[model samples]
Target: MKKELSAIDAKYEAQKIAFGPMYFQAVVALRELGILQFISNNRKGVSIETIIEKTEVSEYGVTLLLEAAEVLGVVEIEDEIVKITKVGFFLLKDEMTRVNINFMNDVCYLGAKSMTESIKNGKPEGLKVLGDWPTIYEGLSILPEPAKTSWFEFDHYYSDNAFPEALKIVFRKNPKMIFDVGGNTGKWSFACCKHDPNVNIKILDLPVQLKVAKANATERDLLDRIDFHPINLLDRSQEIPQGADVIWMSQFLDCFSKEQIIQILENACNASSENTTLYILEPFFDNQDYPAAHHSLVATSLYFTIMANGNSKMYRVEVMKDLAREAGFEIVETYPLIGDSYHTILECRKRA
Candidate 1:
């Protein structure tokens, strides 16, 4: 391990931590004001005068934002010319970064203010920023504008890319019926139908989400192959339907607390027969290859706590496996690092 920071260095680090939100806002301002893009287009570095003239922002405003960005290392000012750095490039053009920035700014930032309250009360106190709901999912249908856009984009970003490979795994046995739990927008169910014409899908989710999912399937002329079941799995009174040869949950379990996850899994066990296979896809934090991936997963736990639900988190592989066993399921296979994605597939069956 490296040496601990000296008192002076520690103070500097603490100041940076205290100013974290301001730093993020500066980055956003740089992008919003078109200064980063202007410098990026010039490439040879643009003078403050030129940026002010080009973007039409006041010189004082431009200078203040760029100066802050220089400290953040997203830009550099040398010989009075500002140049965009690699970090700036990621902020401007990287898809993941773009999605993350928008998601944080639009979906999580304001609600995050209620984090302390959420933690104290074991509830999504931050969710008040959007609407009055126990969790974000109930409010997803009504979430406004770019917040809605960013939310779905962030949600799909981590799970969508894995579908092609996961489809292969799900269809390996050519199951006749697949139950898609938490089938948001019906993307997976549509993919399932296109992958196999003979297979039909049952989508189980909240009524609001089911309405959207059904509309999506109808627009694609795929509704005939997909059915909808609107139920709140969080309610212990609700039970998953039976007769699905395959039960599918893609990036779904992380929305629930550990106890809730076990309860849902147990309900799934009741819905399953010996021949049924339950495929769970998750991006377990510890199973990630990169430290950044792990960091993002852990940070997302707070989002769940403050915005989504009060108790769920991006779980570790061992913790999830234990939950599975507790729910009377036996893991038949574990497929890690599924196809250029940070997801793992657990193939499970009912316990004997």
Candidate 2:
């Protein structure tokens, strides 16, 4: 929303966007090849000859990537000597940055090429790059190599940190049974079980996800208190079973289009009693205080377009509230900025 760019600066920025892919790959190569780390270690700056000698990459490869990195502001070069910039330091060490770059490199990089096709067809046309599946969720468990590792790391990084704080809110009412809707891998379910020994978790998700979740539960010796009800939440014929004091969906609803979200929430309401409290944990862009955090959420929208459902995007807070209202739920309380994480928990109750 900042619209004060000078004409020349705007033109230069446009070119940056045009060559963004090249810049991104260069940075990734530098990181993977240890060239970035090498430069980082030599704070006084390393010579091009030293980088070429110390790393497996050729002199030509090192110089080209370093040149691109310099333009990208990831490194600074003076008198043919290279040193890691502040940005380079983050690229090397920041946990969130590491996850984001890995996800882009492993999961989204190939699929991004089909974005226009995906937009035109309203399907994940790019998903074919990894394997065949309706959406990324269905194929997550079987994703080959670094894709599987990077995908789970990316997905879990955002929601896992918020789990501990969410547990406190969920346990306050002393609920015995909580339904984990779209509970991928039963991570949140495990957290709930550990928080209160008596609480039971019934996870409702795709059969594929439940398979992994159930296995994880069994491995942790928590399956006795946890159960699974496999259902394609998108199917109108399927509804979550009744009898629970809490229904929770963390980082889940944003995976669906607004229309789908309404249906999903309506179904959640159908399974709820007058006393049931529905909790939705999402990192709504509007709720983020920093521009970079907001930027990351919006960028994730393209992943949905090209690789995920191809219909949903990271949503604004007001838009989600509207969807929840139409679904016959009202937000009674909100827990924002939970535990140094960008996630916000919407504590909702069924409207009379």
lDDT of 1 by residue, 1-352 (tens): 9999999999999999999989988888888888889999988888989999999999899989988999989988998899999999999998878888888888889998889998999998988888888789988978987799999999999999899999999999999999999999998999999899999999999999999999899899987889999998878899998899999999999999889999999999999999999999999999999987898889889899999988889999989999999999999999998998889999999999
**Candidate 1, run of 10 with poorest lDDT:** 126-135
* Model 2 accuracy (lDDT, Cα): 0.92
Q: lDDT values of the candidates?
A: 0.92, 0.92
**Which residue pairs collide in model 1, if any?**
none
Relative to the unseen true structure, what is the C-alpha lDDT of residue 88 in candidate 1, on a scale of 0 to 100?
92
Please write out the lDDT profile of model 2 over residues 15-35, one tens digit for every residue: 999999989999988988999
Output the lDDT of residue 162, model 2.
91
